[model samples]
Target: MASTLTDSLVGRLVDGRYKVDSRIARGGMATVYLATDRRLDRQVALKVMHAHLADGASGADFVSRFRREARAAARLTHPGLVAVFDQGVDGETSYLTMEYVDGTNLRRRLHEDGPFAVGEALQVVGEVLDALAAAHRQNLVHRDIKPENVLLSTDGRVKVADFGLARAVTEVTSTTTGTILGTVAYLGPELISTGACDTRTDVYAVGIMLFEMLTGRQPFVGETPIQVAFQHVNDDVPVPSTVVPWLPAEIDELVCALAARAPEDRPHDAPAALVHLRRVMALLPPDVLGRRADAPPPVVSFAQGTPDDTDAPSSVGEIDKIDEIRVGGDTDEADGPVRGAGATDHLTQALDTRASGSTIAFTLPDRDRLAPATGTAPAVSTSPTAPVDADRPGRDRRRPRRRTLVSVVSILLILGALGGGAFWWFGYGPGSFTSVPTGLAGSTLEDAEARLDAAALLHESVEAFHDTVPAGEVISTDPGDGERIPKDGTVELTVSSGIEHFVVPGGLVGASVGDARASLSSVGFTAVTESGEWNLDHPEGTVLGLSVVEGESLPHNTPVVLAVSKGPEPVVVPQVQSLTLDEATEQLEPWTLAPVVVEEYSETVPEGKVISQAPEQGSAALRGDEVTLKVSLGMPFVEVPDVLFTPVAEARTILEDAGFKVEVNYFMGFLGNEVRSQSEAPGTEVRKGSTITLDL
Candidate 1:
């Protein structure tokens, strides 16, 4: 091991940039050091690979994979993920610089202060999930997800570290118990058996971590680490409440769903699990969310180790000496830790052995989806551990198939030797009909068909959209279970094809709301909502557009918002007829109605007063619609003719012809016909019917 004082890179600069400070921690593959970036002026955790890994037989491949995976990890930008800054070969030492976390790793925390309350456990797991969701979106999987890789900062933030580096190290890692067992403790069963994995593999590890958080231990334990790994393949994770009686059923359900024995049974990815967890969180009462469980005694973690400098791979051969396993809590009682001194005593990390470098590739088949105790694990071997052929599933598969074949053969032989009378009765007589089976609704299509075939009944399949039923499951049948049907009668089987989606039909953008609604209904989008806005280009109730694009697909009953036109907004024409023309114009303008003035004579109204309006006052009109205001000019006026010196009859005739009433007055008993005086002044404007006095 390289001592800090004797460390070649300690207190020295690497790659003309990072200044290595003190060593923080050491892992199986690399040594983590606190370092300062001269250019960025920030502290970073520098993970420098050992010399032998850079100079070993497969050195080039190791370097290539290391740089590639590092680059991939750098693409992940999320608050909950430890940010990868840079990766390069500093001469003989290959290194990676990452964001420096200021707090303890989850493994350390769990050892010291975990077995968190359900709420706290849920919160921490939720944060980890949020971080994984970012990687899932980028199509990158974090092959390793144990507590050791989860960094909890002092500021109450959770982050995931070491993305994609596991696969880089797997090809060259030793396969011995020491190299595999410690790291394999949390792996899903499928990864162990088939060496295939996807995002779900990570989900399984998180589920185990969550279980540990809730109960202070992983779900399985054994005499040897291999026994513990086999427990995952053979047994199901027991309910959490089985250990903590106070835990609600929902918590058990959540843990089981994430860590289901079958990979298909678990959530598809971190986001899905996150969604389910939040739902459970929402349903729990405030007290439960706020409650804190009693704390266990802090287990001591590994002391900071001296950096390894020897040519050998660090910690690989220590697994051959394994014997008995002792744990913090009773190993039998539902697989959870009970509170006690050395609550995690023998297994501070359950043998957190630091190796030169090896990791399980997590090459788990999706058919899925992990440790031990010890003294401080001693020096690890660098020799590559050959892969073990522990094909547990294949070894177990034959028993079930043989049992099924024997059962089928036994049933056939007994039926074939039936007496002729009995055979006739069943095939062509009274016993020809069979009763349908019950409890088939949730069965897989294949399973349901097998049951139906046993009944000797003919059946036809039909696919339909179902909101709650999973795909390829029996939804319903024409003749329900337990109903008697003829042997040859065809039963209509409605199978769920999973949640159905419909493409938003074309041409809905310009159609009427009614037409659009009908079109959507025909295609299974029945949950349509109409949102209206005043529009000049479209008629009232015209469909303007949809919430999604025209051809986009959406699930059953997903809300489809119809952006419909409400025509132009209706403008209420105020009682402008009785108002003055100026007042009418001012009131009508704000209603978005355009006003037109029409001047006309009125018998009683004063001039400039609005007499009447088109479409009547207070009637509805579209915005921008024209509203004509008939303004009044009062009574018609006529100029009084000059009647001062005219003859009395002539002046009277002139006044009458000009629409003025005339009255003849006698001057001094008898007046001259030619001379007259008018009541109204000559050429003066007056109401047409006003009386005019004429003197004769």
Candidate 2:
């Protein structure tokens, strides 16, 4: 995906280390690239903001938004969410490095394959809900939940992405950038009307997505955004049964309630909604509930309905013009946006007529675990949008004695009926009893059942998170060890799953090269190093630093970091005599020696000459100091000097002047001192002031 940015980043080193490989994916706001960590020898996904978005005029706001969103998104940890690895500015370019999810966005899937089948849709929705549940728990509301933000992997895993508009819902407003932004279709009514949003807003958007999945069309559509916004506030969500007649009323109710005009009407929060969905799915007919042993199976069904009233309202006023049904304590309201009678007049004058901003305030019951709940306290206003009812009696005195007596009688009757059924089935009837068992460790559910077959005991799993136990391993049991039960009773075993422990690599902050490598290997960690200075905290050679903190359980063989010590300060290179290349370099390290290998042939010396050194070898140095080493590469040659072919007298003069001692000898025909032969051949490289013997 990062291949898209390769052209612009091919030779450019980002942050002085990341070498862009290729563009991976591109969007209007940013381009993502697969890059090589030059120092680490590993791959990473680099998301760089668009050039225009980082220009001087727009850079600051975009940077701030990117930083805040990145941090908020990072706080979330779910298998169904993309992980942000790092974020910072690389010169003028701002970028975020994130876990590269090998998958296609739902938008791409939709574009290539249109709408999904019921089974696939349910699976995707379940995973998306998982991510949303995590975010909602942290009070982060993802204002945008369109198809583009959903990603589907080949492994059938679905992940939610792009928490750009997500912000923490707190008592005080943290973000003032009132730039209302999100996909027009997915935007909630509260965000559109007052820019006041909470978890319910996300629920509404998820509901729209579910509607599209079931009906293959969005619930609301219009030619303009304002028209769409008006629809969200005034229009009742068309029942799934309306489009698909076979759709169950309960499912329709769930969808309608999630997309309720008021937040309270929705099922508490995302988790509650998800629980309801799971329950409905579990109760689906066995004929429709196909099983998958490989992964979490998908549930499927479709409601059948023909096209009915597709004419959605074009404006909020259309509601009042049609139905005068009381929604929010307002009677005689036109078929438009219903306004609470208590604050209706003032709100209409302020919002519809745009009067000098007047605040709309009310007190909601705060039923969704949203406040410091003290067992349903007195009505108190927190948000301007909440509704208040002053007439409801408080818990202290309003409950009637007659009602309590009736409820007690009713509960007693239900319990008696259940007890009678149990007595007939287990005590006096032909049904048998099973005894609970022990030693569930290292035993499969089937194995446990087989062992307890004679005792007639059955087993059931209670799913829970465990750091000291494996997922499928039982942690503890309902019946104590050795406890006896009915021969037909169920044996709930508490199995011990080995504790999940991950080795945390150390010395990564400022370790030397060798020490870093050794530390990682010793701890069974794979290390990635970035080329930069080892700062004050980390010394060279011990592990300088690591990314993930100690004790985080990553899947086996996860990569980690370790900085090693490079050793103490350097010193000047000492002179060498018979020292080998390896020995020379070792001694030179203290002086930061950088050896340059060379070769030469010498009659009086061995091949691979250490012809001598530069800076004459004794130059002073410091840590990381660079010194040049000149080693003989062997067998030096030379072109004949121009004076070689000159007469004997001239040759003698040239040889002496060139620092070569000349000798004259009478060969068979040549004169004394004539250049008939030479001991040192032409093109031979000799040290200055060294003798070059010659004969004639």
What's each prediction's TM-score? 0.45, 0.46
lDDT of every predicted structure (CA atoms): 0.68, 0.56
Provide the lowest-lDDT 10-residue window in model 1. 315-324
Candidate 1 TM-score, C-alpha based? 0.45
Q: What is candidate 2's lDDT per residue for 330-388, written digit by digit as tens?
A: 23355644333423343333233321111112211111111121345689877685534
RMSD to truth, every model: 24.0, 16.8
User: Candidate 2, which segments miss by more than 4 Å at Cα?
Assistant: 1-28, 33-45, 55-59, 111-114, 171-177, 267-269, 289-696
Candidate 1 residues 362-398, lDDT tens each? 2111112222233566888798867445775556656
Name the regions of candidate 1 deviating beyond 4 angstroms: 1-3, 166-182, 294-696
Highest lDDT model number:
1
